[model samples]
Target: MKFIGEFIMLFGIWLLLTWSLAPAQVIAGVVVTLLVTGLAGDIFVFKASRAFNPVRIFWMIVYIPYFLWYVVLANLDVAYRVIHPDLPIRPGIVKIQTSLNTDMAKTFLANSITLTPGTLTVDIKENELYIHWIYVHGKDVKEWSEAIAGRFEPILRRIFE
Candidate 1:
């Protein structure tokens, strides 16, 4: 019952984002959305947390542009390294300690690492994240540790903490 409502709300959001107002297309999309909802049910159980606060969602909308800018900056940095003769990549793994205390927060941290180019989240253990970076910008692990944790963690803390 709760899952049905969540599915419809999420489907409506998808419609608004895509701007699909055509009658036939909207019906088709709803059908596909239902299919996806059914399949994903077993995986996540799709329950809105009892502690869900609308303020978090509002902040996410406010933060979209900032995330997009970071995405673009990371893209250009990767492109620059790929084109330069020097191939300025210093590949290595480093551990980043996170103050995040929930599955949601850890998931967001891992995603942010992967979304930013030049880094991959290799694994997460307790409150630390293991990341593989293509380039160690300053060879300062502490700086890298603080970069993502500081840049994105506050907003996510507001969202999920």
Candidate 2:
């Protein structure tokens, strides 16, 4: 059951990425998905979960709009900094901690930070994530984590953890 769920998710992602309805493309996707599911399906799907809850999927769907909005804002911010006469940027690596327990939640957080325009995830050790910020906001770890991860963390916790 779990394998089936994971395969569906994986194959669905492959389909989205390829956007091909051809028979060969779908057959290849199914073959690849089967191979992955046989090798490491446990790592992909939530442990002990055969299927995702509809409510959680709904929350994730809701989050997409917010995430996209931030991406747009971040692009504008990066553009402004690049075009500014003084080039006001203070880039540095900062460490922060998260209370998110699940591996999926942490991965999502790291990816979200990396997707944002001015931030890139450098490393993650246990619950701590090191991020390279284009503008170092402050040195306070808790405050810094809140500034960077706060937006998505709470929603992720509700969705995945």
Candidate 3:
């Protein structure tokens, strides 16, 4: 059951990426997805009970719009900073403790922060994530961390934790 779900999810992603209906392309995608699923089924598929939670799916769906909006905002902020003559950037690394308990949730938070403009995830030690900000907004670690990662963390926690 888990294998089937993984195969379907992988194949769906393959289809979305390939976007070709040709028989040969689909066949190749299915073959590759199947092989990959077979090799990493355990990692790709969650345990039986958690694998197909509708709540997680709902959160995942909700996350997309929020993520896109944040990305756009981040891009605009970076653009403004670049265009401004003063080059308004403080540029410092801040360590923030993540609210998420699971490593996967922490990883998701780190990746999202890295993907956002003006911020880069430098390192992760246990629950602590170090991020370099192009413009330091505040000196308070908790507030800074919340500004950078709080929005995504709760959604990611619901989806992955």
Top candidate (TM-score): 2
Which stretches of candidate 3 lie above 4 Å from their native place? 17-23, 42-51
lDDT of 2 at 160: 88
Off by over 4 Å in 1: 13-35, 45-52, 137-143
lDDT of 3 by residue, 51-146 (tens): 578888888889888888888989999999999999888899988888788766777788889878688999999888899989788768899878
Cα TM-score per model: 0.75, 0.84, 0.82
Find the 10 residues in a row with the least total lDDT in model 3. Answer: 43-52
Q: How accurate is candidate 1 locally (lDDT)?
A: 0.78
Predicted candidate 3: what Cα RMSD to the true structure? Answer: 2.5
Model 1 lDDT tens row, 41-143? 6565344652355887777776678778878888998999999998989998877888889886788779877888788899999988889888766546578
Q: Count of backbone clashes for each model?
A: 0, 0, 0
Better of 2 and 3 by lDDT: 2
Candidate 3's TM-score: 0.82
**Residues 1-161, model 2: lDDT tens digits:** 78877777889999999999999999999999999999997666464351367777888988899899999999999999999999999999999999999888899899999888699999999999999999998769998998999889889987787
